[model samples]
Target: MTRLLEILISLAIVAVLFTVVGFILPSSRHLEHSVETNRKMPIVFDTLNSVRRFKDWNPSVAGDPNIKLNLSGPESGVGAKISWDSEEKALGQGSWTISKSEPGKLIAYAIEDVDRGHDKSSEFTFTPTGKGGRNIQITQAYDVNYGMNLLGRYSGLYVTSNIGEKMKLGLASLSNMLATIPNLDYTVLGKDDPALAPKLADRAGENLLVLNAAVPLNQITIQTQMKTNIEWIKKNIAANGLEAVGPVRIITNEYGSSIYSFDVAQQVRKAGTDATVKLEGLKLANNVELLYNEPGKTAVVAFKGHMSNLQNVRDALRAWAMTRGYETIDRPYEAWKNGIDPGFAPGQEGEYDVVWAIK
Candidate 1:
């Protein structure tokens, strides 16, 4: 009994000395992990911007099902924040808010403890890599100050192994997420105009339930007509007790200053004859008709603000396609992944992905 007691005392003293020594260690630590992805910077930026998808790839949320999580503000970019609380000690409780956003370049976040205020800093930087900016170098980093707490300071020893491993895992998940995305690149025309960047992507055909609208080959009211078609599609889909599966797509073959033709449609799950949303003055093209986006090469660009400004982007895309060997197989289309809000003033920003099918 006496020998056991001595051994226990010695062990306790050793722990005390270890913690005491930890006090002299640096209280601040910075770690970074990087991964190369074949996806373009915009897709990587978009993926990281969407915090709603974090539960799928984030290491912290990977295993925990009981965490109390509250997501507030915008789902992506500035003002986005996610607070999570857990009974697990390693998980603890805290909130992270995007503090700064420089689109396509960097995104920074500040972490705050639920009870103690400011906690740490984390960020992701996207650097263009590979040929013609077709690839991206994704760097995720964290800067943490352990303070004077011995246990906290001692935790610094594991930052490289623990936090770094998590970053690596997260990056791997991100790479996998982007792997199947069509190979795309960009030729930035101006820093002030991301929409005019002349981007390109490789896309595969998808099953769609679209509402087709045929209009005059040359009409200045195309934007207005586009919205009209969207409203019809939405109302009819809701009328059918169904929901659109994805973004609204515009289909067309002819477009010029003097001539234009188009089809405005919404993507939907493919189903049999009975499953259809019939819109007034429009046909629910129940067939998987013009869904093929050639086996490779498509033109894409950022479209925002007034849909009218999209004309400039389309012109730029045509110029880009002409410069390359690509030929336009269809009319320009906008994928409205996020709902369209046509009320924004000029120069104000929004998210709308435009694709032009080419063979």
Candidate 2:
């Protein structure tokens, strides 16, 4: 009877200890991790603002290749969401929705997990660091409320090994991804105006009369060559029973210090049918060829500047495309908004739609 009584007292004491410790534990948990990168603010912010590229840099995705993911809501900023289902017990099922976005500053997400319950959030804040603020320091923070749940408070003890470790891996992955993108500042092309930012667009396939030429890097020389090419194209268009359908396009093949090599192209179509004529039967002039530009995606930007500046704008467009994880597939080109004659006039400032084919 004495032995039985001692055993009962020891059991009661152990239960009391567990309860006391559970009550003493905090009901809330916060985890933070940071990483630094030389990438620009916009590049880092854009990556986190949209769930479109979530699978690319997310460590969790890499850990579970079989995880299925779905994207919903807007493509970027607040309301963008990504949901995932994984066979792995650790991942289970969950969704992350962008709850707040401050361009170049911060992005916050509301996280939901079947096993973790609710009232969980994560955020990424950006701060300019290093010389001339060229480098960026990114801090990721996670917060969870356990309320009165003792089990959850105890689970918080492992949060560092679980959630904290993931954040560090994720930020490292993000830095590596950013390294692949071009570091050029695209805003220089638009003079810092968001309205003039480079944008992705679709280009329909079209039949073009193309004339390739190499000319001395002089405005007058370039203009003369283009004019000669356009006249030849006009004659061919008339003979082929086709009409010029769009402004002249200049595809830059090479822009050397002393020489410029380019293709002068014009879209053409049958007058009433709006369809291009077959190239096989068409009569061609010297140095001119019929081409069918295949339909594809492109990065485009509007620029009002001299022809000499077009090359710089093309570079900027390419940088912008790279930052968005796009690959360039063809040479850059420009559609002259103003007629070729006036666009090449001395001291003339012309408007053009600079385009770079990308995939």
Candidate 3:
């Protein structure tokens, strides 16, 4: 009787010890799953990188149809930021910052949740494969101090799977959506070296006519023309809910009814504000050109202020072209800063686009 009782008591103590050890010992709860989806890498990466676009793929956006999102920095490139306040634990108060981005290739970001632990980072890679398709691979990693490591692991896995699955689906859907839109080849002007323009002209047996579209020309009474263009631009700006900059000068090559010059920049300023458009860190100076160099096509449209948003302008233009059934044949031209300081008056950036028949 004594031995039996001792044995039972010893077993009970051993069981308790084992139970305690199991609870205290560090363990990880992790889960990860992936699905292959079809989507262009650029579109996927761009959508993920921009908070404005993230809504299309975020599965955690629930119960807060009106969550306020504050945007800072550029719209889509590196150094973009989005701060959001959400009630959902999966997307509690946090901001997504672009840590690194390689256009159409890879993007990595860090998620800082004010309510959740410290920080978590995720990386997404886009790989092009055979059969005219692209595969997006997403990997999420979590790191935390010992005790919370378990929770971190589980959260990371769940969030990653959930978000990754949505991303895949969104990307797939986006691909389908984009496919429905006709694949139009954007007009990118072949690089005609400023240095080679003379040579090309010589070979073509033509005058060495350099088209300068930057500054306003000394000739031409363009007050009415400028007003007309500015008014047109203002309407477009309002339509897109973007601010307007100018009815600024436009470039036109003309001397008494015979077009000799192609500088449209001066044409815009004649009737509009004198201050030039401002852009910081724009490496490439450009000469703006019209899509169809035809007669009576002079017009101006205000591209919203974010210089980084030139793509939006391009995308908008592409859509416009599609609607008009016009084919773009030349690379879009731009004027390097018209020697204007953007700081003088913010939101005054505008462009004057003009075209003339080549006789």
Q: What lDDT does each candidate get?
A: 0.66, 0.84, 0.42
lDDT of 3 by residue, 1-359 (tens): 99999999999998888667645644443223333434445444545556554544444344478776777777666677778887765567777777888876767766676423454555556665546564555433333222444444334445445545655565554454444333422222112333211011111111111224322332232333333444554443344333423223333333233322333332211123332332122121222221212222211123324333343444444433322223344334233234223312356653322221111
Error at 30, model 3, angstroms: 7.3
| Cα error of candidate 3 at position 108, Å | 0.6
Best by TM-score: 2
lDDT of 2: 0.84
Q: Model 1, range 82-124, lDDT digits (tens) per residue?
A: 8888887777877778888898889898877522212688899
Name the 10 consecutive residues with the lowest summed lDDT in model 3: 198-207
For model 3, the superposed segments whose C-alpha errors exceed 4 Å read: 1-44, 87-90, 114-118, 132-359
Who wins the lDDT comparison? 2
- Candidate 2 TM-score, C-alpha based: 0.83
Candidate 1 positional error at 313, Å: 11
Give the runs in model 2 whose Cα sits over 4 Å from its true position: 1-16, 114-117, 187-197, 214-225, 254-261, 276-280, 294-297, 321-328, 341-346
Score residue 107 of candidate 2 by CA lDDT: 95
